[model samples]
Target chain A: GAGVSQTPSNKVTEKGKYVELRCDPISGHTALYWYRQSLGQGPEFLIYFQGTGAADDSGLPNDRFFAVRPEGSVSTLKIQRTERGDSAVYLCASSYTSTGELFFGEGSRLTVL
Target chain B: AQSVTQLDSHVSVSEGTPVLLRCNYSSSYSPSLFWYVQHPNKGLQLLLKYTSAATLVKGINGFEAEFKKSETSFHLTKPSAHMSDAAEYFCVVSLPSGTYKYIFGTGTRLKVLA
Candidate 1:
């Protein structure tokens, strides 16, 4: 794609429901990142991927949040047993390297009821 | 480890007036700093970035920031504030966490009053 693209710009789900958010990164980009933004806050790092493997997952918060970049081009963020606190904007970004500007998606606003 | 601190949680400025948003950072290495802006329903857009090169960096929308190593600050400024400039701004410092990982500040919400 021309830029980072995310699916289901808005998602509404039950507290216990599992949800999957998808991201398609910019073509040929080698790094992908996931972030979560709460109301009135900046984006928090959730994970980082270098190619198809996750280089750092320390920011995932808890096991309930998991992300996968299967082919190094697209990624998915999966949440299990969602909670109301999980309502926030999930952002995806891609970069050509680890030290350049990042291209961001419009973001997926996940609302858990 | 690296971290960024946005001095103000919110800032209000009259339209066409000068604007300033303060940011400070901590890092173990010569870090890369960046400023990102987010409108109501849009993605984050990079305003500018400061690597180890220039001390002053200019960005889109007539915004600029100066990287002060001694002060550990990268403050965003504009000569004139526009109503369209009202948005949330974030300061980010790249961490040596093995990838393109970043430590973001809490963010400053800019409000331009007409």
Candidate 2:
């Protein structure tokens, strides 16, 4: 079975630019999640989607961060006016259900210079 | 108010020796505890989970963790340390027993000496 997959393994952009990270969850997974990991730190929760709707967005740091999973199979994490502080490895995970065990992607490393 | 704490920042053990990674947690409700491992330049992988169903849980690669409610701990242990086990390990907690939200610990870096 194919596991979760992310796009653009590495990205480098200016501080004021915009970036969108994409994730493709495993087939039949109904719950998707986004997380960010800073260097030398554990992954921090960003948002979660149950089906096509977001189940939890409280972990999003600010309004500049947004995510969507319209069809429930693929998701994208959008960042506006990216700051140097936003540089980190963005991770995506999916589960069969909200409470099911998570399967993770390799991650998209974003660098805001 | 759910949180997980990994007592050690780093641990080192000789190959074929015992391995132990300590973790403590705080939560308002009964929590779901998990251990995840991350190799260099790779994403996190689930090592095992404890959902109160079993105090001792076995996971892939001969890894296991024991949940102790009295000490608020879920420490991971293995009888023999392998070089492949050298990686960053994270302890995570979910509140209300079965929730999607997770609170991750600081993590422990395990090094295997041959």
Candidate 3:
């Protein structure tokens, strides 16, 4: 069985540029989550989606971050006017439901120069 | 609000020795505690979880965590350390119900030496 997966394992971009990271969740997972992990830190929640609807986005850092899950299986995290502070590994995880055990994907490492 | 604290940022142990990674949590209610491990170049893997089921929850790879309500701790322990056990471990906490909003602690990097 395929676990959650992300595209563009590594992305390097200049500051002020826009970037998009994609995540493909496990089939039948109704809950998708996005988190960010800075070096030497644990993953911090960003946004959570439940079947095409965002159940929570409070963890999003600010207006510069946004995420969407249109069909409920795949999601994209978009960043506007990227800053060097945003340079970190963006992780995606999915679960059967909001309270179920989560399965994580190999994070997409974004390097903002 | 729910939060987890990993007391040690790094722990080193030799193979065949006991391994203990301390973690403490704070939550308004009974919390769902979990221990996850991540090897270099790999995603996080669920080592074990402690719901309301049992106080001593056993997880994969001979790892276990005992949920202590009195002490507000759910520390992970393993009898024998293996070289492969060298990885970053995270202690996470969430509410028992509702949205299951998670709060992760700063990771503890394990070094298993031979």
TM-score of each: 0.94, 0.98, 0.98
Query: Candidate 2 on A16-45: residue-level lDDT in tens?
Result: 999999999999999999999998888999
| Model 1 CA lDDT for position A105 | 96
Candidate 1 chain B weakest lDDT stretch, 10 residues = B94-103
Query: Which of the predicted structures, 1 or 2, would earn the higher lDDT when compared with the native?
Result: 2
Docking category for candidate 2?
Answer: high
User: How would you encode candidate 3's per-residue C-alpha lDDT over B28-82 as one tens digit per residue?
Assistant: 8888899999999899999998888899999999999999999999999999999
Query: Any residue pairs clashing in model 3, and if so which?
Result: none
Query: What DockQ do the predictions score, one after another?
Result: 0.68, 0.81, 0.79
Q: What lDDT score is found at residue B102 in candidate 3?
A: 76
Better of 2 and 3 by DockQ: 2
Question: Best-fitting candidate, measured by TM-score?
Answer: 2
Please list the residue runs of candidate 1 whose C-alpha ends up more than 4 Å from where it truly belongs after superposition. Answer: B97-99
List, residue by residue over B7-93, the lDDT tens digit for candidate 2.
999999999999999999987789999999999888789999999897999999999999999899999999999999999999999
**Model 1 complex DockQ against the native:** 0.68
lDDT of 3 by residue, A1-113 (tens): 99999988999999999999999999999999999999989999999999999989999999999998988889999999999999999999999978899999999999999
